[model samples]
Target chain A: AQSVTQPDIHITVSEGASLELRCNYSYGATPYLFWYVQSPGQGLQLLLKYFSGDTLVQGIKGFEAEFKRSQSSFNLRKPSVHWSDAAEYFCAVAADNDMRFGAGTRLTVKP
Target chain B: EAGVAQSPRYKIIEKRQSVAFWCNPISGHATLYWYQQILGQGPKLLIQFQNNGVVDDSQLPKDRFSAERLKGVDSTLKIQPAKLEDSAVYLCASSLEPSPYNEQFFGPGTRLTVL
Candidate 1:
Protein backbone atom coordinates (compact mmCIF):
# COMPACT_ATOMS: atom_id res chain seq x y z
CA ALA A 1 0.00 0.00 0.00
CA GLN A 2 1.19 3.50 -0.86
CA SER A 3 1.18 6.18 1.79
CA VAL A 4 2.44 9.73 2.32
CA THR A 5 4.11 11.22 5.34
CA GLN A 6 4.42 14.82 6.43
CA PRO A 7 6.64 15.19 9.40
CA ASP A 8 5.59 18.68 10.40
CA ILE A 9 2.34 18.83 12.30
CA HIS A 10 2.42 22.63 12.59
CA ILE A 11 4.89 25.21 11.33
CA THR A 12 4.96 28.90 12.12
CA VAL A 13 6.93 31.11 9.82
CA SER A 14 7.32 34.83 9.56
CA GLU A 15 5.51 36.41 6.67
CA GLY A 16 7.69 36.95 3.57
CA ALA A 17 10.12 34.29 4.73
CA SER A 18 11.13 31.25 2.79
CA LEU A 19 9.09 28.09 3.38
CA GLU A 20 9.72 24.43 2.83
CA LEU A 21 7.35 21.60 3.76
CA ARG A 22 8.79 18.13 3.89
CA CYS A 23 7.01 15.14 2.34
CA ASN A 24 8.04 11.53 1.91
CA TYR A 25 6.23 8.63 0.34
CA SER A 26 6.33 4.89 0.89
CA TYR A 27 5.87 3.12 -2.40
CA GLY A 28 7.51 0.39 -4.36
CA ALA A 29 7.67 2.38 -7.59
CA THR A 30 7.77 5.96 -8.67
CA PRO A 31 4.19 7.07 -8.04
CA TYR A 32 2.45 10.22 -9.10
CA LEU A 33 2.97 12.99 -6.54
CA PHE A 34 0.74 15.94 -5.73
CA TRP A 35 0.53 18.90 -3.39
CA TYR A 36 -2.75 20.47 -2.33
CA VAL A 37 -3.73 23.37 -0.11
CA GLN A 38 -6.91 23.87 1.85
CA SER A 39 -8.21 26.91 3.66
CA PRO A 40 -10.60 26.92 6.54
CA GLY A 41 -13.99 25.56 5.53
CA GLN A 42 -12.96 25.54 1.87
CA GLY A 43 -12.24 22.83 -0.66
CA LEU A 44 -8.76 21.75 -1.55
CA GLN A 45 -6.90 23.41 -4.41
CA LEU A 46 -4.11 21.76 -6.35
CA LEU A 47 -0.70 23.30 -5.83
CA LEU A 48 1.25 21.06 -8.16
CA LYS A 49 1.97 17.47 -9.25
CA TYR A 50 4.86 15.38 -10.44
CA PHE A 51 4.48 12.36 -12.71
CA SER A 52 7.87 12.18 -14.41
CA GLY A 53 10.43 14.14 -16.37
CA ASP A 54 11.95 17.12 -14.55
CA THR A 55 12.60 16.69 -10.88
CA LEU A 56 11.79 20.33 -10.17
CA VAL A 57 8.14 21.17 -10.87
CA GLN A 58 6.58 24.59 -10.55
CA GLY A 59 3.07 25.14 -9.31
CA ILE A 60 0.53 27.89 -8.77
CA LYS A 61 0.92 30.68 -6.16
CA GLY A 62 4.65 30.99 -6.65
CA PHE A 63 5.24 27.52 -5.25
CA GLU A 64 7.41 24.71 -6.52
CA ALA A 65 8.44 21.17 -5.62
CA GLU A 66 11.38 18.95 -6.37
CA PHE A 67 10.87 15.22 -6.69
CA LYS A 68 13.83 13.20 -5.52
CA ARG A 69 13.52 9.56 -6.49
CA SER A 70 16.57 8.69 -4.46
CA GLN A 71 14.88 9.75 -1.26
CA SER A 72 11.32 9.03 -2.32
CA SER A 73 10.48 12.59 -1.45
CA PHE A 74 8.77 15.59 -3.02
CA ASN A 75 9.22 18.61 -0.85
CA LEU A 76 7.22 21.79 -1.52
CA ARG A 77 9.08 25.09 -1.43
CA LYS A 78 8.25 28.74 -1.64
CA PRO A 79 10.90 31.43 -1.69
CA SER A 80 8.64 33.87 0.02
CA VAL A 81 5.39 32.96 1.66
CA HIS A 82 2.64 35.48 2.08
CA TRP A 83 0.09 35.64 4.84
CA SER A 84 -2.51 34.25 2.51
CA ASP A 85 -0.41 31.16 2.07
CA ALA A 86 -1.20 30.03 5.56
CA ALA A 87 -3.29 26.91 5.30
CA GLU A 88 -3.23 23.15 5.56
CA TYR A 89 -0.86 21.50 3.12
CA PHE A 90 -1.18 17.91 2.05
CA CYS A 91 1.10 15.61 0.09
CA ALA A 92 -0.31 12.67 -1.83
CA VAL A 93 0.89 9.68 -3.80
CA ALA A 94 -0.93 7.58 -6.37
CA ALA A 95 -0.20 4.03 -7.43
CA ASP A 96 -2.12 0.93 -8.39
CA ASN A 97 -5.00 3.09 -9.59
CA ASP A 98 -5.37 4.53 -6.12
CA MET A 99 -4.22 7.49 -4.08
CA ARG A 100 -3.30 8.11 -0.45
CA PHE A 101 -2.76 11.37 1.43
CA GLY A 102 -0.51 12.52 4.22
CA ALA A 103 -1.61 13.74 7.61
CA GLY A 104 -1.13 17.34 6.39
CA THR A 105 0.87 20.23 7.87
CA ARG A 106 -0.77 23.28 9.31
CA LEU A 107 1.03 26.48 8.30
CA THR A 108 0.84 29.68 10.28
CA VAL A 109 2.19 32.95 8.97
CA LYS A 110 3.29 35.44 11.59
CA PRO A 111 3.54 39.09 10.88
CA GLU B 1 -15.76 24.25 -16.76
CA ALA B 2 -17.64 23.97 -13.51
CA GLY B 3 -16.00 22.19 -10.59
CA VAL B 4 -17.36 19.22 -8.67
CA ALA B 5 -20.52 19.93 -6.72
CA GLN B 6 -21.56 18.63 -3.28
CA SER B 7 -24.70 19.41 -1.40
CA PRO B 8 -25.70 19.86 2.24
CA ARG B 9 -22.71 21.95 3.24
CA TYR B 10 -23.48 20.98 6.83
CA LYS B 11 -25.36 18.21 8.58
CA ILE B 12 -25.93 17.30 12.21
CA ILE B 13 -27.35 13.98 13.28
CA GLU B 14 -27.62 11.97 16.44
CA LYS B 15 -26.13 8.53 16.95
CA ARG B 16 -27.99 5.71 15.14
CA GLN B 17 -29.45 8.30 12.74
CA SER B 18 -29.02 8.14 8.99
CA VAL B 19 -27.50 10.73 6.69
CA ALA B 20 -26.84 11.07 3.00
CA PHE B 21 -24.60 13.25 0.88
CA TRP B 22 -24.99 14.14 -2.78
CA CYS B 23 -22.28 14.95 -5.28
CA ASN B 24 -22.47 16.05 -8.89
CA PRO B 25 -19.31 15.73 -10.86
CA ILE B 26 -18.18 17.98 -13.64
CA SER B 27 -19.72 17.33 -17.03
CA GLY B 28 -17.85 14.77 -19.14
CA HIS B 29 -15.80 13.52 -16.22
CA ALA B 30 -15.45 9.73 -16.19
CA THR B 31 -13.89 9.43 -12.74
CA LEU B 32 -15.39 10.45 -9.41
CA TYR B 33 -14.11 10.10 -5.88
CA TRP B 34 -15.46 10.44 -2.37
CA TYR B 35 -13.23 11.27 0.58
CA GLN B 36 -13.62 11.41 4.33
CA GLN B 37 -11.62 14.12 6.09
CA ILE B 38 -11.60 13.97 9.83
CA LEU B 39 -10.45 17.07 11.65
CA GLY B 40 -6.67 17.42 11.77
CA GLN B 41 -6.25 14.53 9.36
CA GLY B 42 -5.78 14.22 5.65
CA PRO B 43 -8.56 13.23 3.32
CA LYS B 44 -9.08 9.47 3.16
CA LEU B 45 -10.45 7.84 0.04
CA LEU B 46 -13.70 6.11 0.75
CA ILE B 47 -14.67 5.07 -2.75
CA GLN B 48 -13.95 5.64 -6.39
CA PHE B 49 -16.17 5.28 -9.42
CA GLN B 50 -15.39 5.17 -13.08
CA ASN B 51 -18.39 5.70 -15.30
CA ASN B 52 -21.06 4.47 -12.93
CA GLY B 53 -19.01 1.47 -11.85
CA VAL B 54 -17.01 0.89 -8.73
CA VAL B 55 -13.30 0.90 -9.34
CA ASP B 56 -12.03 0.90 -5.75
CA ASP B 57 -13.92 0.78 -2.49
CA SER B 58 -11.65 -1.19 -0.24
CA GLN B 59 -11.45 1.57 2.34
CA LEU B 60 -15.18 2.17 2.54
CA PRO B 61 -16.96 0.66 5.50
CA LYS B 62 -19.57 -1.31 3.59
CA ASP B 63 -21.33 -2.35 6.76
CA ARG B 64 -22.86 1.10 7.15
CA PHE B 65 -21.71 3.22 4.23
CA SER B 66 -23.20 2.85 0.76
CA ALA B 67 -22.59 4.93 -2.35
CA GLU B 68 -23.92 4.88 -5.89
CA ARG B 69 -23.37 6.75 -9.11
CA LEU B 70 -26.26 6.03 -11.38
CA LYS B 71 -25.92 6.97 -15.06
CA GLY B 72 -22.34 7.98 -14.31
CA VAL B 73 -22.99 11.64 -13.57
CA ASP B 74 -24.20 12.23 -10.04
CA SER B 75 -23.55 10.25 -6.86
CA THR B 76 -24.98 9.80 -3.41
CA LEU B 77 -23.38 8.43 -0.24
CA LYS B 78 -25.52 7.14 2.57
CA ILE B 79 -24.53 6.17 6.11
CA GLN B 80 -27.15 4.40 8.14
CA PRO B 81 -26.97 4.17 11.93
CA ALA B 82 -24.25 6.71 11.99
CA LYS B 83 -21.52 6.68 14.61
CA LEU B 84 -19.63 9.50 16.24
CA GLU B 85 -16.47 8.55 14.45
CA ASP B 86 -18.25 9.08 11.15
CA SER B 87 -18.41 12.82 11.78
CA ALA B 88 -16.19 14.45 9.23
CA VAL B 89 -16.17 16.40 6.02
CA TYR B 90 -17.13 14.43 2.94
CA LEU B 91 -15.45 15.74 -0.15
CA CYS B 92 -16.28 14.95 -3.76
CA ALA B 93 -13.81 15.21 -6.56
CA SER B 94 -13.89 14.48 -10.29
CA SER B 95 -11.52 14.20 -13.16
CA LEU B 96 -11.67 13.41 -16.82
CA GLU B 97 -10.06 10.07 -16.11
CA PRO B 98 -8.18 8.17 -13.44
CA SER B 99 -4.90 8.95 -15.16
CA PRO B 100 -2.47 11.25 -13.46
CA TYR B 101 -2.44 13.65 -16.39
CA ASN B 102 -5.97 14.70 -15.66
CA GLU B 103 -6.15 16.72 -12.46
CA GLN B 104 -8.93 16.08 -9.99
CA PHE B 105 -11.05 19.06 -8.99
CA PHE B 106 -12.68 19.07 -5.57
CA GLY B 107 -15.90 20.47 -4.17
CA PRO B 108 -16.53 22.49 -1.03
CA GLY B 109 -17.49 19.30 0.85
CA THR B 110 -20.29 18.41 3.24
CA ARG B 111 -19.46 18.78 6.94
CA LEU B 112 -21.14 16.05 8.95
CA THR B 113 -21.44 16.37 12.71
CA VAL B 114 -22.65 13.38 14.66
CA LEU B 115 -23.97 14.22 18.07
Candidate 2:
Protein backbone atom coordinates (compact mmCIF):
# COMPACT_ATOMS: atom_id res chain seq x y z
CA ALA A 1 0.00 0.00 0.00
CA GLN A 2 1.28 3.46 -0.83
CA SER A 3 1.38 6.12 1.85
CA VAL A 4 2.20 9.81 2.22
CA THR A 5 4.11 11.51 4.99
CA GLN A 6 4.02 15.16 6.00
CA PRO A 7 6.80 15.81 8.47
CA ASP A 8 5.57 19.20 9.60
CA ILE A 9 2.52 19.18 11.80
CA HIS A 10 2.19 22.94 12.09
CA ILE A 11 4.05 25.78 10.44
CA THR A 12 3.82 29.46 11.35
CA VAL A 13 5.25 32.26 9.28
CA SER A 14 4.89 35.99 9.13
CA GLU A 15 2.93 37.63 6.37
CA GLY A 16 5.01 38.04 3.17
CA ALA A 17 7.41 35.29 4.32
CA SER A 18 8.23 32.34 2.14
CA LEU A 19 6.66 28.96 2.84
CA GLU A 20 7.59 25.38 2.09
CA LEU A 21 5.66 22.29 3.13
CA ARG A 22 7.34 18.91 2.82
CA CYS A 23 5.68 15.71 1.65
CA ASN A 24 7.14 12.28 1.06
CA TYR A 25 5.63 9.13 -0.35
CA SER A 26 6.38 5.42 -0.21
CA TYR A 27 5.59 3.58 -3.42
CA GLY A 28 7.18 1.07 -5.79
CA ALA A 29 6.58 3.03 -8.95
CA THR A 30 5.91 6.57 -9.96
CA PRO A 31 2.73 7.66 -8.25
CA TYR A 32 0.37 10.52 -8.69
CA LEU A 33 0.94 13.28 -6.14
CA PHE A 34 -1.47 16.05 -5.21
CA TRP A 35 -1.53 19.06 -2.91
CA TYR A 36 -4.81 20.24 -1.44
CA VAL A 37 -5.81 23.04 0.91
CA GLN A 38 -8.75 23.12 3.26
CA SER A 39 -10.12 26.07 5.14
CA PRO A 40 -11.83 25.69 8.46
CA GLY A 41 -15.16 23.88 8.03
CA GLN A 42 -14.64 23.72 4.27
CA GLY A 43 -13.83 21.01 1.76
CA LEU A 44 -10.41 20.15 0.37
CA GLN A 45 -9.55 22.19 -2.68
CA LEU A 46 -6.99 21.15 -5.28
CA LEU A 47 -3.87 23.31 -5.18
CA LEU A 48 -1.75 21.30 -7.62
CA LYS A 49 -0.85 17.82 -8.81
CA TYR A 50 2.11 15.98 -10.35
CA PHE A 51 1.44 13.26 -12.90
CA SER A 52 4.47 13.14 -15.17
CA GLY A 53 6.60 15.68 -16.94
CA ASP A 54 7.76 18.93 -15.46
CA THR A 55 9.16 18.31 -12.00
CA LEU A 56 7.86 21.73 -11.05
CA VAL A 57 4.10 22.11 -11.35
CA GLN A 58 2.08 25.27 -10.86
CA GLY A 59 -1.31 25.38 -9.31
CA ILE A 60 -4.06 27.76 -8.27
CA LYS A 61 -3.64 30.38 -5.52
CA GLY A 62 -0.02 31.08 -6.32
CA PHE A 63 1.13 27.64 -5.19
CA GLU A 64 3.68 25.34 -6.78
CA ALA A 65 5.13 21.92 -6.00
CA GLU A 66 8.27 20.18 -7.14
CA PHE A 67 8.43 16.45 -7.58
CA LYS A 68 11.73 14.75 -6.80
CA ARG A 69 11.78 11.14 -7.87
CA SER A 70 14.92 10.24 -6.03
CA GLN A 71 13.76 11.70 -2.80
CA SER A 72 10.22 10.36 -3.17
CA SER A 73 9.06 13.80 -2.21
CA PHE A 74 6.77 16.48 -3.52
CA ASN A 75 7.18 19.73 -1.64
CA LEU A 76 4.83 22.70 -1.90
CA ARG A 77 6.37 26.16 -2.00
CA LYS A 78 5.31 29.78 -2.12
CA PRO A 79 7.56 32.76 -2.44
CA SER A 80 5.32 34.86 -0.25
CA VAL A 81 2.57 33.92 2.17
CA HIS A 82 -0.65 35.83 2.76
CA TRP A 83 -2.88 35.72 5.78
CA SER A 84 -5.63 34.13 3.73
CA ASP A 85 -3.22 31.36 2.74
CA ALA A 86 -3.38 29.99 6.22
CA ALA A 87 -5.07 26.62 6.13
CA GLU A 88 -4.55 22.89 6.44
CA TYR A 89 -2.51 21.47 3.59
CA PHE A 90 -2.68 17.84 2.61
CA CYS A 91 -0.44 15.71 0.45
CA ALA A 92 -1.85 12.64 -1.25
CA VAL A 93 -0.79 9.75 -3.45
CA ALA A 94 -2.98 7.58 -5.62
CA ALA A 95 -2.58 3.84 -6.04
CA ASP A 96 -4.92 1.75 -8.13
CA ASN A 97 -8.45 2.83 -7.19
CA ASP A 98 -7.60 4.26 -3.80
CA MET A 99 -5.72 7.34 -2.69
CA ARG A 100 -3.72 7.63 0.52
CA PHE A 101 -3.15 10.92 2.35
CA GLY A 102 -0.73 12.26 4.93
CA ALA A 103 -1.53 13.60 8.37
CA GLY A 104 -1.62 17.13 6.93
CA THR A 105 0.22 20.35 7.79
CA ARG A 106 -1.45 23.38 9.27
CA LEU A 107 -0.16 26.71 7.96
CA THR A 108 -0.50 29.89 10.02
CA VAL A 109 0.42 33.34 8.75
CA LYS A 110 1.02 36.16 11.16
CA PRO A 111 0.90 39.91 10.60
CA GLU B 1 -20.04 24.48 -14.14
CA ALA B 2 -21.27 23.59 -10.71
CA GLY B 3 -18.83 21.80 -8.37
CA VAL B 4 -19.65 18.82 -6.20
CA ALA B 5 -22.59 19.48 -3.89
CA GLN B 6 -23.20 17.95 -0.46
CA SER B 7 -26.20 18.43 1.78
CA PRO B 8 -26.51 19.25 5.46
CA ARG B 9 -23.46 21.30 6.24
CA TYR B 10 -23.48 20.01 9.81
CA LYS B 11 -25.17 17.32 11.87
CA ILE B 12 -25.27 16.47 15.55
CA ILE B 13 -26.36 13.15 16.99
CA GLU B 14 -25.90 10.90 19.98
CA LYS B 15 -24.19 7.55 20.05
CA ARG B 16 -25.99 4.66 18.33
CA GLN B 17 -27.97 7.15 16.26
CA SER B 18 -28.32 6.91 12.51
CA VAL B 19 -27.15 9.54 10.02
CA ALA B 20 -27.14 9.94 6.26
CA PHE B 21 -25.17 12.26 3.94
CA TRP B 22 -25.96 13.11 0.36
CA CYS B 23 -23.70 14.16 -2.49
CA ASN B 24 -24.31 15.37 -6.03
CA PRO B 25 -21.25 15.19 -8.23
CA ILE B 26 -20.31 17.35 -11.17
CA SER B 27 -22.41 16.48 -14.19
CA GLY B 28 -20.92 13.90 -16.56
CA HIS B 29 -18.23 12.80 -14.12
CA ALA B 30 -17.68 9.07 -14.17
CA THR B 31 -15.91 8.62 -10.86
CA LEU B 32 -17.24 9.52 -7.42
CA TYR B 33 -15.58 9.09 -4.03
CA TRP B 34 -16.46 9.35 -0.36
CA TYR B 35 -13.81 10.40 2.15
CA GLN B 36 -13.69 10.61 5.93
CA GLN B 37 -11.67 13.45 7.42
CA ILE B 38 -10.98 13.43 11.13
CA LEU B 39 -9.77 16.53 12.88
CA GLY B 40 -6.00 17.05 12.58
CA GLN B 41 -5.83 14.39 9.90
CA GLY B 42 -6.02 14.22 6.17
CA PRO B 43 -9.01 12.92 4.27
CA LYS B 44 -9.20 9.13 4.17
CA LEU B 45 -11.02 7.42 1.37
CA LEU B 46 -14.03 5.47 2.53
CA ILE B 47 -15.34 4.30 -0.82
CA GLN B 48 -15.04 4.76 -4.54
CA PHE B 49 -17.65 4.36 -7.27
CA GLN B 50 -17.23 4.41 -11.00
CA ASN B 51 -20.45 4.88 -12.86
CA ASN B 52 -22.74 3.41 -10.25
CA GLY B 53 -20.43 0.44 -9.67
CA VAL B 54 -18.20 -0.13 -6.71
CA VAL B 55 -14.55 0.19 -7.50
CA ASP B 56 -12.92 0.11 -4.08
CA ASP B 57 -14.41 0.17 -0.59
CA SER B 58 -11.74 -1.62 1.39
CA GLN B 59 -11.54 1.06 4.06
CA LEU B 60 -15.27 1.46 4.66
CA PRO B 61 -16.46 -0.10 7.88
CA LYS B 62 -19.19 -2.17 6.29
CA ASP B 63 -20.59 -3.11 9.68
CA ARG B 64 -21.85 0.44 10.12
CA PHE B 65 -21.13 2.36 6.95
CA SER B 66 -22.85 1.95 3.60
CA ALA B 67 -22.82 4.03 0.45
CA GLU B 68 -24.37 3.89 -2.98
CA ARG B 69 -24.34 5.78 -6.28
CA LEU B 70 -27.39 5.01 -8.34
CA LYS B 71 -27.64 5.62 -12.09
CA GLY B 72 -24.09 6.91 -12.02
CA VAL B 73 -25.13 10.22 -10.51
CA ASP B 74 -25.84 11.27 -6.97
CA SER B 75 -24.44 9.32 -4.01
CA THR B 76 -25.54 8.74 -0.46
CA LEU B 77 -23.57 7.51 2.58
CA LYS B 78 -25.27 6.26 5.67
CA ILE B 79 -24.08 5.23 9.10
CA GLN B 80 -26.20 3.03 11.27
CA PRO B 81 -25.79 3.27 15.01
CA ALA B 82 -23.02 5.76 14.71
CA LYS B 83 -20.22 5.68 17.24
CA LEU B 84 -18.44 8.54 18.95
CA GLU B 85 -15.43 7.86 16.76
CA ASP B 86 -17.57 8.46 13.71
CA SER B 87 -17.52 12.16 14.41
CA ALA B 88 -15.83 13.73 11.42
CA VAL B 89 -16.46 15.38 8.08
CA TYR B 90 -17.83 13.35 5.20
CA LEU B 91 -16.48 14.63 1.92
CA CYS B 92 -17.62 13.77 -1.59
CA ALA B 93 -15.48 14.26 -4.65
CA SER B 94 -15.86 13.65 -8.37
CA SER B 95 -13.43 13.33 -11.19
CA LEU B 96 -13.70 12.91 -14.95
CA GLU B 97 -11.78 9.68 -14.64
CA PRO B 98 -9.95 7.56 -12.11
CA SER B 99 -6.60 8.87 -13.30
CA PRO B 100 -4.49 11.37 -11.40
CA TYR B 101 -4.21 13.80 -14.29
CA ASN B 102 -7.87 14.64 -13.85
CA GLU B 103 -8.56 16.94 -10.96
CA GLN B 104 -11.04 15.86 -8.31
CA PHE B 105 -13.54 18.48 -7.29
CA PHE B 106 -14.75 18.29 -3.72
CA GLY B 107 -17.89 19.41 -1.92
CA PRO B 108 -17.99 21.54 1.20
CA GLY B 109 -18.57 18.33 3.19
CA THR B 110 -21.05 17.32 5.90
CA ARG B 111 -19.68 17.63 9.39
CA LEU B 112 -20.97 14.99 11.80
CA THR B 113 -20.61 15.39 15.55
CA VAL B 114 -21.43 12.24 17.43
CA LEU B 115 -21.89 12.88 21.10
Candidate of highest TM-score: 1
What would the per-residue lDDT of candidate 1 be over residues B54-90, giving only the tens digit for each residue? 9999999999999999999999999998999999999
lDDT of each: 0.95, 0.94
Can you write out model 1's per-residue Cα lDDT over A1-83, one digit (the tens) per residue? Answer: 88899999999999999999999999988999999999988889999999989999999999999999999999999999899
Task: Kindly list the per-residue Cα lDDT of model 2 for residues B33-106, writing each as its tens digit.
Answer: 99999988889999989999998899999999999988899999999999999999999999999877788899
Minimal lDDT window, size 10, model 2 chain A: A94-103
User: Measured against the native two-chain assembly using Cα atoms, what DockQ does each of the candidate structures obtain, in the order listed?
Assistant: 0.82, 0.81
lDDT of prediction 2 = 0.94
True-vs-predicted CA distance for residue B77, candidate 2, Å: 0.4
Which parts of model 1 have CA positions greater than 4 angstroms off? none
Off by over 4 Å in 2: none
Reference-based lDDT, residue B94, model 1 = 93
**Chain A TM-score by candidate, in order:** 0.98, 0.99
For candidate 2, the per-residue lDDT at B15 reads 96
TM-score of each predicted structure versus truth: 0.98, 0.97
